[model samples]
Target chain A: MDPQSVERPPSVLLAHRMQGHPVLVVGGGVVAQQRLEKLVPTGARVTLVADHFTAAVEQTALQCPQQVRLVRERYRESHLNLEPYWRLILVCLPSGAANHSDDAKGQSKSESDSEKVYRDAKRVFGAQQSVNVADVPALCDFYFGADTSGCPTGKGEGQLGSMQLLVSSNGVAPRYAALVRDELVRHLGELPLAQSLDRLDELRAAVREEAPGPEMVAVRMDWVCALTDRLGLRGAASMDVQEELKKFKDYCKERGEQVKSPSQDN
Target chain B: MDPQSVERPPSVLLAHRMQGHPVLVVGGGVVAQQRLEKLVPTGARVTLVADHFTAAVEQTALQCPQQVRLVRERYRESHLNLEPYWRLILVCLPSGAANHSDDAKGQSKSESDSEKVYRDAKRVFGAQQSVNVADVPALCDFYFGADTSGCPTGKGEGQLGSMQLLVSSNGVAPRYAALVRDELVRHLGELPLAQSLDRLDELRAAVREEAPGPEMVAVRMDWVCALTDRLGLRGAASMDVQEELKKFKDYCKERGEQVKSPSQDN
Candidate 1:
């Protein structure tokens, strides 16, 4: 049995809602910048510690002063004691020029050197702190997919910040996983994923107003849920909101009766 | 902008690899059981606190005694201070009589009753601890997708445990997301996803052995990456692994020369 395979378990994908939460980043290179790009959207209060930072990192910190705090010095144990303790730590330290050359395939020297560094840092961090170390899978508590394209962007109908689709193979076959992700993203673009959702949300709200009774709650949910199928993927994109609301009002009278008048044992 | 929208920020999807790590799950009904199903696959050491548990939950706990620890009591502050303080806490308490009737849509009586409970629990938990309360989106630090079907099931070609394709709308349009997920799963069924990946992995390993040395590292990676395209999606599934390995060894000689003999006007 491969020791490495045993080290890596299946990844449990989650939606981490880190609004107004303090997070620590321990590097300031392009890799660290990439982590920040993902973190900034979550609205996390990030404190970046590094000897020096890239121009992009400096600009980002300057832009989001309140969201980001910069520490212009090397790392120390005391840095962990920052007033508002950071529960999530992203270690973005340099793992010896990996992309610089193919010598990285040498494996033994580079692997052990970086592995030792990553292992040492993981040990020193607080037991409670979840460390996500870059370049080292074994040391990471969680893996950042680090792709923003999954979240649809743009103004009006195209902007669906909530729409998140992810494809992963737990690093077994990342190339294939990425290929499938691209295919899905293209498929999502053709469909009105955001617009349909927005319409359904509005329709749900409208139905709630029309049927203002507790008894109508299940009816509304079931009705809206059914409507989702009726709308399917494309129908809601071209739906008439006001006309649908009026139509829903008339249909509710009959739908409500159907559920109440249960002819058979449920 | 709606106030609800203000509270609910866009979700950041992360692949959490929680193997042999301690996680706490409060409550032990159907909802907690749902959460346990997701956690069990991650190999997380879970401590579930609840007065009573569902049959499924009890069976799972008994089966994986090493992974799950059950506390037959109501939740207390001290539960947070267990020997290994749980960084991730899942609160799965009953949010009133939801699913019982249409009263769930009242938005006032049941909403406030459950909202207050979720809010109060969120406040009492450790400042650093990330809590995921069932149903209360605002109170949750993170949201459990609570679905494991994304990871392919069964054995042989179908057993792609690593192949995880997730579709989410951040709760904005769950119905639509689910519809798309079902479609993708059906699409995945027809493709030999795991077989191709396994073949590619074997090919890469074989090439690394055939073309040994620091210089061949770049050549090996580039060659394997290019082969991924040549093999494409279905091509690798039907590929002969032994024959392919032999071909890769022969190809290495020509590929190495191409990189070395760079043509330039200069």
Candidate 2:
């Protein structure tokens, strides 16, 4: 067995409500800027602790002072003491050339200090907080895979046909995961995914009102399967909701007899 | 604006390391059982505080006694009092039926107990913890969108080609999000996504070694685009890595002049 095979598998979860949550970010570079962009729309109260800020981070902080707070100071152990408030922590240090430049100049003290900061933060908040250290997968409780298109801002008026697609390799193959994600994003908009969902919701409500029972579970599952098949054949964009609803009603009527078998015997 | 448009947009984050973290789950119904199935593989130390357990949860606890602990009691304020230790909390109480049933029987005490449990949990752990209350979107700090497939067990030999896809609707249309997730899962396995990632990793390393410079980022981006186009035209199964590598070398050699323009000016 490959040694990597011993590692645990990744569990993908979607966190919907992050608004007003306090998030601590330790860095002021391009990566930090990217993270801030993503976090902005979530309305997370972001506190960024870094000695310096990139122009982009400064611009963003200026634009949304209420959402983002920038403290132009180096990281210290005292930061982690805010354990009761910060829900998420992100560390995005410079990598590659910039990281090596410090090493080349024998600035090992700063490097070690940053490392210690990461370690202490994790130790202090590791049990309860979600931490992601950019470019350092081993230390991360979470991994932010490549999101080519920035996270969507929740301004719904112009987003009539917009859909967000998240593809995660659980840090396995981020580059590949990203490539597939971009491709799928292109194909997804053509399909009326949200419309199909609305129609399904309507159909489910109808089903519940007309025939609510123990067998509704199986009946709904079958209906979903059948509807998906039809969508697959004709595509969601052209799905006729009224016709499908009529067809679903008929299908439920037929399954009604079968569903009563065990109950009748009882 | 649609009333739903006022809701916050969903943020999709992938958490990779959940090993041995204390997670509190309050409920033992089908949804809780489903959540357990997903959380089991992450190796999270799960403490389920529910008055009862579904047979599936019971069997799972029996199988993995060390990972999962069942309290066999109702939720209380004390659960949130484990503030320093518990990392994630998930509440999967049946909303309308079980809740109304309590009201019907004048068991307002139990009903209020459940509501208070939720309220207190949020209050005690709101700032630092990750909380998701099923069916009650407003009280949740996060939402668990549908994951039809159980979390993959990372016995990595056969999973060389495996990939995890996470689709979240931010509660806009969960049923739709789930349907799209299921459909995407079906289409995903057919693509040579994993293989492309492996090849890209190799190419990135080669590019870094052979053409190390500021322009390398753009060059690599272009190369990935070209490679993806080729993969789309041919297919991942039939991708000739050696041939692609040679083509990449040639492409780099051809773009060598343009890549050097900025350096030459400097």
Candidate 2 structure quality by residue, lDDT tens digits, B1-266: 21112355546455446677778888888888988888887787788888889999999999999999888876656766544666678887755333432223434544434455566665665556677766555657666765533623332213334455566666655656666766665556466555755565555555445555433645765676666655661264466655665566667667663332232232
Colliding pairs, model 1: A218-B102
Q: Which stretches of candidate 1 lie over 4 Å from their true place?
A: A1-8, A96-126, A146-161, A206-223, A239-266, B1-9, B96-125, B146-161, B203-231, B235-266
TM-score of candidate 1 on Cα atoms, chains taken together: 0.74
Per-candidate TM-score against the hidden true structure: 0.74, 0.70
Sorted into a CAPRI-style docking class, model 2 comes out as: acceptable
lDDT of 1 by residue, A182-229 (tens): 555655666776777778777766676666554455566667778777
TM-score of chain B of each: 0.71, 0.65
List the candidate 2 regions with Cα displacement exceeding 4 Å.
Answer: A1-8, A79-84, A96-114, A122-126, A147-162, A194-266, B1-6, B79-84, B96-114, B123-126, B151-162, B194-266
Clashing pairs in 2: none
Q: Top model by TM-score, which number? A: 1
lDDT of 2 by residue, A1-266 (tens): 21122244665455546677778888898879988987887678788988899999999899999999998877766766644667678887653223332123444543444355556665775556677766555556766664423623332213323245556666555556666766666556556665655565555555544445433545655676666655652264466655665666666556554332232232
